[model samples]
Target: MTAPTRAAPAREWADAFAAASNEDPEIQAHGKYFTCTYLLDATERSYAIKMESGRVTEVTVDPGPLDVPYEFAIRATPETWRGFGEPVPPPMHHGIWAATFQRDMRLDGNILVLMQNLRCVTRQIELLRTVGSPV
Candidate 1:
């Protein structure tokens, strides 16, 4: 199959994440603990992923401020995001914690929620490589 766009819309990423998560046993097992909307701010654009009982029920691209009450928000520069989306990301780009520690990504709002669902979030991010190509 042809590679996806370098900067594909958030809906695409969200859909990919949902599909990947559904197929991942780890995500499915741990996703039950996560049931909330999360915002992904790609600097230039934004999207929201809504998870219900460990399943991704909705993905909204360019969601307005009041569209969703996100439990948390993850923000990163487009450049940083491109790195994270690599099939085999380098150090500091391999995971959200690494990126956050390296100052490449930022987490805003309920940190506790993010921590509780770290595994699911990480898997979702890893799936990014499958759907998003380098810019």
Candidate 2:
């Protein structure tokens, strides 16, 4: 039998992240009310991900200080982000809450928005295990 064909890998972290989030079944099924924009700040770089009804509308890379508008920001050191990039993150690196409380990670800006869309946000971020971290 011929070998199975696999789609070409994404060229960059942003591309991988977008592809992963956009094509996820969980996001599509439960994201009907998940609409928001947020920043994933890795200290080394930043990604502004905008979601509309559970779909990733846009993903801006390294936006200027005021170029892109986001409701909240998940900020962390590059070192901390590397831990998240792992396929199986270590104890303190497992989730946003864990890292935020245990590592050098911060959730800033409008926190209520983050909480409002917490479920989808959590699922989207969990995609990092498959898509890897942007840092």
The best candidate by lDDT is: 2
User: What lDDT score goes with residue 26 in model 1?
Assistant: 78
**Deviation in angstroms for 122 in model 2?**
1.0
Q: What is the C-alpha RMSD of each candidate to the true structure, in Å?
A: 3.5, 6.3
Give the range where candidate 1 is weakest over 10 consecutive residues by summed lDDT: 126-135
What TM-score would each prediction reach against the true structure? 0.86, 0.88
lDDT of 2 by residue, 1-135 (tens): 977522222237788888888899988888898888899988768889989999988889888989989999999987787787778888898789999887589999999999988888888778887877676
lDDT of 1 by residue, 1-135 (tens): 988667655556667767776787878888877788898888787778888878888878788889788999999988888888788887788888888898878999999988888888888888777767322
lDDT of residue 111 for candidate 2: 98
Go through the candidates in order and give each one's C-alpha lDDT.
0.80, 0.83
Which residue pairs collide, candidate 1?
none
CA lDDT of 134 in candidate 1?
21
Model 2 CA deviation exceeding 4 Å by range = 1-11
